[model samples]
Target: MAENEPWQDPRLPEDARLTSLEKRLKQAQLEDAARSGRNDKASHKGRSQGMRILSDLVGIPFGSALIGWLIDGWLGTRPWVMLALLFLGFGIAVRNVLWIARQRPE
Candidate 1:
């Protein structure tokens, strides 16, 4: 148990200890990177999904309503066709959002 008796110790050599520490450090770093990578992927997925939901929710309805308005103008249908088509667009958008949500991975 002498303080300066490391060389005499019947244990791992200094190089072996250093190598073991290096291995542990490398493993820990890899594990940390893997954990952070998973988190990044999860967050990125969530953000992208939110954007997709927003787009599906807004874009489809807007496009449908615009088309409906154009058709109404061309057909001289007043408000009847335009309103019906707008509601149809909204319903389709809702259905799509629900379908997309259901398709998400657990």
Candidate 2:
């Protein structure tokens, strides 16, 4: 063949050539993402789960405490009554956590 002409290697069949080209493109894209430290599906899932658990813990305690404080304050009680109710709220939160844990699949 002429030096300026494109080189066509006859050994590789047409389908094999197309498959190899596609594989290389995918590999290059994955490599670029890895180099950039991007979060893929697995990492995103883990992060989301962690956020959910944190929110659950904080939400349960805060919501219960707020309601307890409101009830105690409306009833004209001081710190002692609110403190007792807060403890009860904590116990309820713990029980809810246990129930949710049990319902989760292994």
Candidate 3:
């Protein structure tokens, strides 16, 4: 209400009641997730798998291109070495993806 004071939302009073309600709600949600077999571990495993795939798809090619660029710069071969390594990196990435696909879920 003051010129410089921060205003609080009336619907969400910061008090003991709100804190207790929040704790209860979180507990209920967690219990529900566990009962439904959709808990954090399952989601985390899915996210981890997705991240691994993403890293393999992007990191390998980019890393290879970077190394090839450096080599090209040193050897004065311009784009030839870089292109070759970039393609090789793509091939490796594909192979890794196939390997991952064949892996049994943990």
Q: List the RMSD of every prediction in angstroms.
A: 11.3, 10.6, 5.7
Candidate number with greatest lDDT: 3
Q: Give model 1's TM-score versus the native structure.
A: 0.60
For model 1, name the residue pairs that clash: none
Q: Which of the two, 2 or 3, has more TM-score? A: 3
Cα-based RMSD of candidate 2:
10.6
Sorting all predicted structures by TM-score, with the top scorer first, yields 3, 1, 2
For residues 8-72, what per-residue lDDT tens digits would candidate 1 score against the true structure? 75664456666788999999988997986655566777777778889988988788888888989
- Predicted model with the maximum TM-score: 3
The lDDT values for all models are 0.78, 0.68, 0.84
Q: What is the lDDT of candidate 1?
A: 0.78
Candidate 2's displacement at residue 67, Å, is: 0.6
lDDT of 1 at 68: 84
Among residues 3 or more apart in sequence or in different chains, the pairs in candidate 2 whose N, CA or C atoms overlap within 3 Å are: none
Candidate 3 residue spans exceeding 4 A from truth = 1-39
